[model samples]
Target: MFQIGRIIMPSPLLRRLLAALVLVTLALPSAAAADCYVHYKAKRTNPYGLHYGIIRVSGGCPSSPGGLVQSRISSGGWTILNVVKVTTSSPSSSERRSAGSHYYR
Candidate 1:
């Protein structure tokens, strides 16, 4: 038997359930910190071109993902124009098609 404030919790099963709930609560933040997807528009000038892309960013999504996206694609000489969206879900088939060669980069 355990007393929590004015409530009495008497069952061992209830204690186990409470313990599990606490553990899952503690785990929520780390789960939320998992990798995220960034959808963005970029441009490369020479011949002059534009593309839309979806990229997986590990360690979680930033409040502002533009700088990170620019850095990742800079090696290919692409400049990020704007972030279209950020989400935990992968891009849909239509989105992947739109991204074309830029998909998952």
Candidate 2:
């Protein structure tokens, strides 16, 4: 109902809040997120043990090189997970993305 319906995220905080509001809509199992879905077969050579992930955006993800979702694996400590953005159909102009190293900076 989020992506297909009207979602009003007026500001960044509101957007985060709106996104948070929909978290309960998913029927996630604790063990399920441990296995994230990899859409691009070309990238996933060994698709055996991908760790957990949370769906931040609904429409697959933003179209950065990897796709529109981000994920991480946890051991004794959390591992560095890569975020991806993608589309099933041909992407539009807004879908293209460039990764920046200075995201946190």
Candidate 3:
């Protein structure tokens, strides 16, 4: 039978390399990370006090750019405070959407 001695590796070097990789990744900005959009809804009423509009929850990831999962903007749940009224000069082009946007927890 043949046995090999225990081989040890430096921990500091590995840690440094990992840290560098993380820094590089974060430094490079992408089109991700929303910046507080809007969740414009019909609000059950309108500027003209009319109740003849549509109600929907589209996309609103600009209200809270930092909106994140397990925090504010999540997929499994919904936020009431983020709900708002959708406004458009063209009456035919108005619809509701989500307010806050986030990535993951």
Q: Please name the candidate that would achieve the greatest TM-score relative to the true structure.
A: 1
Runs of candidate 3 with Cα error greater than 4 angstroms are 1-5, 20-35, 39-47, 50-105
lDDT, residue 6, model 1: 100
TM-score of 1: 0.78
lDDT over C-alpha atoms for residue 13 of model 3: 73
Candidate 1 lDDT over 1-105, as tens digits, reads 888999987789888999999999999988888889999999999768899999998878898899989989999989999999999887899999999999889
**Cα deviation of 91, candidate 2, in Å:** 47
Please report the TM-score between candidate 3 and the true structure: 0.21
Model 2, 21-89: lDDT tens digits are 777545454324332222221123244333333333333434462433323222223333554423333
Give lDDT per model, in order: 0.91, 0.35, 0.34
Stretches of candidate 2 off by over 4 Å are 1-9, 28-105
**Each model's number of backbone clashes?**
0, 11, 11
Models 1 onward score TM values of 0.78, 0.17, 0.21
lDDT (tens digit, per residue) of candidate 3 on 1-105: 233467555477777998999988996653243233223222112233211222222233333332332133223343323333332222232232211222111
Q: 1 or 2: which has the higher TM-score?
A: 1
- The 10 consecutive residues of candidate 1 with the worst lDDT sum are 55-64
Q: Which is the leading candidate under lDDT?
A: 1
Error of 3 at 14 (Å): 3.3
Give candidate 1 misplaced runs (Cα > 4 Å).
2-10
